[model samples]
Target: MQPYKKLFTYWFAVIIYDLTVDFTKSYIKSFKLKEQMDGAARSGKQNIVEGSEGMQTSLKSAIKLTGVAKASFEELIGDLEDYLRQNNLKQFPKNNPKIEIFRQKAAVLIKKLSDFYKNESLVRNLSNLSYLEKYFNTSSVEEKVNLLLTLCHQETFLLNKQVLSLEEKHKTEGGLTEKLYKARVQHRGY
Candidate 1:
């Protein structure tokens, strides 16, 4: 389990959760609607963790769970995009100046969180000016969700690659049942 892989996804979920929980409180005046958002975030993180933990015993199940995680993130990202559209908020361009700043902040926060877990390589640092906590209250809900959508894109990229790897491994190596059968044959000297 690469820290930057599933671990990054988990942190991104936590980051979005933190942002949305605050934003929705004021924006919507209630937490009821956030249950759907929370579901997606929790599913994305939990599925990845479960899949990683089960990989040793069931690679196929792990792959399926990872796909589920990817889908959950996609669902959340889609909902955010729709919200922006319905509310007439523009999605920021990839090269927007604020995006660069947000990316820098994300890099720092991810690195710090990774370091707290003793996984420094989980992120790369490019700035030291400030963390998102300082800017959260000042930034718009649209901005926060837009930034999170960018991260969702990265997570999907990693997930697609991971699924491809899993598929290839399953094709070449088969599954646990086949391995168990082979082990049994070897033990019987057949």
Candidate 2:
């Protein structure tokens, strides 16, 4: 298969995985939890599709978008695990185990895409940066500085978004097990 096609397949797999997870999550009790999981799963697939749709005109941007999708998937998995543990339902065969399996599947897909894009061809190089610098053809030092700063801001925004998602996952996961355990015990009148 062609390289682009491979990328498309990867994105497609993510979309399918997300849909399946979302469907299964309907049986879950917490609406807030379900909404968060649904959002993350949708974001992962949407990013991939959106990026792939733009690949021909903006390869660098498309790859970056795909990265975002992977990051979203990672965050979703983390949150799901946390939710299960928080409810003290972590070891339950009906809940946590199935999610773990889905998480593993998503991880495999993420790893495959990461491996495929490890080369320079799919990324921006210093040469490309230089070209952009020259293309602007700005003679004033202040103007050059401004342009570079804008680029930096854009890059930083993307990085920070990914970081925030991961951190949210961590925060949500913590104390999840205790909460779940308590709820379970309470329900059991113990």
lDDT of 2: 0.48
lDDT of 2 by residue, 1-190 (tens): 3344344334333433444253335445777766776776667667666765655455455656767876665665566455446655423232444334443443454355556645545333222434333444434433332322232223234445544553554356534455678889999999
Question: Cα miss at 148, model 1 (Å)?
Answer: 1.7
**Candidate 2 Cα outliers beyond 4 Å, as residue runs:** 1-25, 91-190
lDDT of 2 at 40: 64
Clashing pairs in 2: 85-177, 86-176, 86-177, 86-180, 87-180, 88-180
lDDT of 1 by residue, 1-190 (tens): 3543436555665566555555455565435557777677678877887887777899899899989989988987887787789789999988988777777666666556655645553222212112344643236677777777766776677677878888899899998999999999999999
Best by lDDT: 1
Q: Write down the lDDT of every candidate, Cα atoms only.
A: 0.70, 0.48
